[model samples]
Target: MDWIDWGDAPTWLGAVFAAAAAGAAVWTLKSQRDQIDEQRRFIAEQSMNLGLERQALLAAAQERHEAQARKIRLYPQAPTYVQVVNDSDDPIYDVHCEARGMPALHAVELAPSEGVGAGILADLVQGASRPYVHRLGVGREAWFHVVTNERGAVHIRFTDAAGNKWVCDDAGGLHEAGA
Candidate 1:
């Protein structure tokens, strides 16, 4: 192999290589720093946008529910319009005219002597203990489980039974008692 001549190398060539290496190092470092700053800025912007978008979505959903007339009407106007919802999906029994208006108060009563109306009454009376009164929506709206199996209250309301009123929940549970 031929021996390399370090002395013969041009003096300016070494300076040129050193200058280029330094320039390249500076460029690489600056580029990396700039990229890190840009990424941080991008992440911060996304977080702010997400928070705003979440609030907007919640507001929109609330607006949609509030705009519905039927849902609005479902909210009780008086304390008596509410009934305590038992945590069951059974049929309603012993529907009386007095129970029709809002629950006004929760009270326990003897089972109706007449027994529940034929069809749904049979189902509602199942496992039904002494009659109980629970003021629904007394202080606030309540989420009651509606039982639609028995239609006695529905029929009475449709036929216009005098002194007979009914409270129907959104889910179709109807309560009635002689007023």
Candidate 2:
């Protein structure tokens, strides 16, 4: 029996081993890339959730502020006088009352409807203020004309404790007033 020579067999085996090592390195790199992409996706989702939560918190704060503004009430006791009441725990500032036309929804005293406006507060109102009612020929000389009638509503603008300005009407319509 003759033993056959296995020349260069070790070098051939080394080449095969090198190829396998290269393949394993490529697989490891691909796995790492996939993991990085998955992490990026997770981070993006978390950011969007945080943004939505922030928006919800802001909306809730605005609702609470408007609720505080609704505590003020205005009514006409007689033709000569008006009854202004503040039901809230906190005092509101710069309160201005005006009679708006029903059709146009415009304030009658639009000209000086600021600090020196008629039927308005020159100073910060604390609780209840009984001021002289202005003579309005519309709706039987009522300080606050009802929405049920053809006459307009009585609206009041005031500043809240948080420095937010608001405008509310006797008919339950409320909105944020811009500076």
Q: How many clashes show up per model? A: 16, 0
Give lDDT: candidate 2, residue 179: 34
Residues 67-155 of candidate 1: C-alpha lDDT, one tens digit per residue: 32112113221222222232222222333222333222222222223222344233333523223323222122222112321223211
Clash count, candidate 1: 16
Residue 27, model 1, lDDT? 100
Q: How do the predictions measure up, each by TM-score?
A: 0.35, 0.60
Task: Choose the strongest candidate by lDDT.
Answer: 2
lDDT of 1 at 88: 24
Candidate 2 local lDDT, 35-142, one digit each (tens) = 999999999999999999999999998678677677766554333223345566666665556554332111222111232234432221221233222222211211
Best by TM-score: 2
